[model samples]
Target chain A: MKWYQKHRETIVQTACLLFIVLFAYAGLTKLLEGHLFYDSIRNSPILGGKAMASLASWALPLSELAVALLLIWKKTRLIGLYGAAVLMLLFTGYTLAIVFFAPYRPCSCGGVISLLSWEQHLVLNAILLLLALMAIWSSLKNKGIPWKKTPQGR
Target chain B: MKNLKLILAMLAFIFAIGLSFAFMGDTGSGAWINYNGVPTELELDPCQGNGNDCKVVFEDDPNQTEYTVYTDDTLSQTRKSNNPEPYIIP
Candidate 1:
């Protein structure tokens, strides 16, 4: 079997697993630090007005959780991957926008995500987004192909 | 494709989640509304009577006047100012 054929399944599975864990952690952080997250949203420049900011604070985490849950199931993994890509893009774009244009930066994103500098955060998000795309594309191509069995399971 | 609807629904569900999150915090933690209704914290003591510490605006009252508040200066005359307003502590 060709190298691409041999490793395609492994790559897709890893991507799915990565997204599942990433979204779950992201969601749990928001749930655990709900108050801090809300304050952060209220301080956000993107979600103008109190109402939208307030909603985003909690919505972010739950959305992450929803994405993770969807990715976990074989039947819904594609949908989950698509959602993950959208969320990642939105997050990355927000980070880039605030860093470059906003008068004041809001540190609402708590946990390890917050620890990264804006530039670093953007890069990390971009990487994840790319991974989601690769996973989705590979899965789509592998739809009708028989699984290539390797003697040593990766 | 039917799967397309599912993807769209997933995104829509998040917006609903955002609404729920917005309503979750009854009293916004670590923040208070300022004159503009922006979420901010009082970094300085409001009761200290430092004229620079706070700006109190009674929008509904007729005074419609702006003042640099100075009061509670009993201990230190250097920071105290006598204002005609009776309610303002000196």
Candidate 2:
């Protein structure tokens, strides 16, 4: 077997699990200490003291959990990867914006990653996004076709 | 999806944690007080009327063991409440 086909399942599985941990921890922290997350967002130059603060608060954790759930299923796994990449892209963009523009940026990130500086956070998000993209490409290569064309098997 | 229950479990977990924080309210007890839900300390001059009149008051302080270690796991630094509101030193 070729290198990718030999290790395709492992690679995809590892990617999914990594994202599961990432999303779960980040989402759980926001939920556990929601007030801080909410306040931090509210203090942002983009979102601060706005009516949308409450919406972002609920939507963020909920979306993270949703993407994580999608990743757990084989049929929906690709969709989950896409979801994760999109979320990470948004987060990376937000971090970059804050680093460049915001005069008083607040760290709203949860989990141990909160210990990282904003620049480090951007790099971390970028790494995750690249991993997710690699997973998507490898999965497509393993199947020999797009995911939708594959037979549904248990 | 083979594992539908796992999704439900995660949702339940999220709800449980969120509800716990919500029910606990914004502030915490002990030596520090939560300012607008954010833990903060009053850096006042405990002798002058300009701002500080009282020192760090604790529930049980016979030895005056100043508690400096805070329960701050947040990304932002500890917020300090000044006397004049937005104390800008030029």
RMSD of each: 12.6, 11.4
Q: How is the predicted docking of candidate 2 categorized under the CAPRI scheme?
A: incorrect
For model 1 the local lDDT of residue A12 reads: 79
Query: For residues B1-90, could you state the per-residue lDDT of candidate 1 as single tens digits?
Result: 856534544444454445435434343222122324333432211222223332333324576543332323221122221212211111
Tens digits of per-residue lDDT for model 1 on A1-154?
A: 5998899877877787667666776686678666556545554556544677568867888899889888766788878888998998898888778778765444434544645777788789889889887787888777863346447767
Once superposed on the true structure, which residue ranges of model 2 sit more than 4 Å away at CA?
Answer: A146-154, B1-90
First chain TM-score, candidate 1: 0.86
TM-score of each: 0.59, 0.62
lDDT of 2 at B6: 57
Q: Which ten residues in a row have the lowest lDDT in candidate 2 chain A?
A: A103-112
Which ranges in model 1 have alpha carbons more than 4 Å from their true place?
A144-154, B1-90
Question: In candidate 2, what are the lDDT values of residues A32-128, reduced to their tens digit?
Answer: 6676576566556655654566887889988987887787777888888899989998888888887787654454444466568888888888899
Task: Tell me the interface RMSD of every candidate, in Å.
Answer: 12.9, 9.8
